[model samples]
Target: MSLSGETIRKIREAIKSAFPNRDELVMMLRMELDIPESEVPDGSNYNLVVFNLIDQLDRQNRIPELIKGALNERPGNPDVQKVAQEINAIYSNLSDKPLLKSFEFDVVTVNAQGWKISRKRCRAQYFTEDLGNGVTLEMVAIPGGTFMMGAPKNEKDSFDYERPQHEVTVQPFFMGRYPVTQAQWRAVAALPQVNKELKPNPSYFKGDDRPVEQISWYDALEFCARLNFTINVTTQRDYRLPSEAEWEYACRAGTTTPFYFGETITTDLANYRGNSTYGNAPQGEYREETTTVGRFPPNAFGLYDLHGNVWEWCADTWHKNYEGAPKDGSAWINDNDNPILRGGSWGNLPVLCRSAFRFYDSWAERDSHDDLIGFRVVCAFGRT
Candidate 1:
């Protein structure tokens, strides 16, 4: 590898000190420049020698203030000067004036998997891309394991479509922590796509922090396309909607129940109807619109709004039964282009809000932004 600017500059200085003639020093360093970094032992000696030089010059009372003044003129040059001063102080405190031997040191470093730091150099790295605005998207670390994916057919409010409870193994995937917001949508809308359309002035009921509604399945797909491009996730695995099984599995966090909270759901538990005393107990506010995401408690898996707040978009095509559904958690195909939507909306009654409930919408139709239709995102791991 090529030498860093700091290393190259030091070699130039060393050559100057040894040869005295600038032309001869330049020729020597040019020859040495091709040497591999691994072959350079005492690579750190450059810093130690500079520190020692500053100490010697100061002790001799021969420090040229002109040189110090020139260094001070550069903006960040004080950092170097500060280290030089620290070295001089250490020299004065030591029994012997050997800067390297006299200095005491301790270094600590912490790193994640596949990365490490040694001395002043870092060894391994994986790129992290900023999704946009103030948000950054990083790879989520999920260990490979089996999770109970679908609800049983006999469960309360269970639909035939959720039948054939299966154990699916998800091999470590990354997902967006929050539902896609208006700002993220606009970020994608700015891209060039004729079929990709968005609200002229996208409005969230609560705010941009509230999940962006009023987007169609087609529009959401386009947004994912731009998002995939923005973060450079694999184009082969498009960031489409999550399947019914994946959504429930993530929402449940490995629990088997009618609601993640338990058999009954309350306003305190989720943002659903609470005021009307139904078959359960006391009722809550008769809110006609969707509440802000994360307004209530999250499930065991740290997923928010899986119960209420708003209905989320699913990738599967609508199906009346799960008799022949994919056991591997892939989306089941719907007639023509109709896609399945899941998680009952805010306006929905208590019976409709059950986790097993299934809904469908035409892919071409746009979301009403009625504060009842919001969305989350899913991405295949290692691919995108």
Candidate 2:
């Protein structure tokens, strides 16, 4: 009846404001909500009507197109902005994790990587999972496939460490739509500890939707453990830091470029020091601090902040090369336990964020939090 604390009502209001004279649209919308013509909508009841409509339309593949069209027509219009924000807000609040599966985008790869020929894509399928406590995580379901791991030998920025371009077959996995945010971090931190106790708020730059930083690899693991504990009780799925292979494969989506978006890296597409440029791109802004997640366009996988924003932690220990790495997507564990990190941070050079670029830190210093490092989680399906 409350419609998840009035959020549904806000979304409806936003939508109505965006399209003032669409009686035909309302007909479908009302039916989606299952609202009888005789029922008088009031207060929270307004949300019930809207939420019902959203669920029904989503299943019928009717909502995303309409929402996208309306928002895209006037993305900067105040009313349209409110509509997009409200919808995104609801997406972030649903407990089951509402995923907007769209096959409406195209795949791009570097000249070398594209030679192998990968699957075609239409839309970047995007989904979000609720973590309770009014917190949610957005994710993109990456279709499993085989791709060459590391950088190709002739890539403009290729490095020997990323060379020998080995083949890696990754299974389908749900990766966070964006890096973990302060709000999400606080929500999970409140959960009972799985290994080490987590500080409820452990970020350097404070913003609700900004990626949570200044956390160590151990902290990232603890978040995954506690998350899996709560999520698995019902879903029977495990949550953990993605293995290095999974991280790269997902970051690249189906692209073979220096960055998933294209051959060049720009601050406009990500949050990073803008004084430097890569490829033919020009230098841009230096925000000096992290920006809100999802501020930029998503890669083909419907993933945001993959190239920059924060250097994400990976499950594998630091490896000098992939000569003997696992071919089947499992993490390569090592005795030293030096943690592997990828996706470069807001303060890093553009080159560091390149898809094959790799770096590490003394994993023993799990508490050595830095503003440059953060992590995302992978929800392992059919895995308990």
Off by over 4 Å in 1: 1-129, 135-144, 147-150, 204-206, 233-238, 276-279, 361-371
Evaluate model 1: give its lDDT: 0.51
Model 2 lDDT per residue over 342-381, tens place: 8988888888889999887554355668988888999766
Tell me how many clashing residue pairs each candidate has: 6, 14
lDDT of each: 0.51, 0.71
Q: What is candidate 1's lDDT per residue for 1-384, written digit by digit as tens?
A: 132345334433432244444343234323433323232322235554444433443454423221222222221343433433332333223232111111112211212111113222212111233544464332222234576655676675566666566677655444455566665666556543424556634655746556677666666777776554323221222356777777766666555656655555666556666564324445667676666665765554445677776777777777666667676767777565666667676766655666666776544234434456767777663421
TM-score of 1: 0.59
How close is every model to the real structure, measured as TM-score? 0.59, 0.68
Runs in model 2 with CA error above 4 Å?
Answer: 1-122, 361-365, 382-384
Model 2 score (lDDT): 0.71
The candidate scoring highest on TM-score is: 2
Model 2: how large is the Cα RMSD against the reference? 13.7
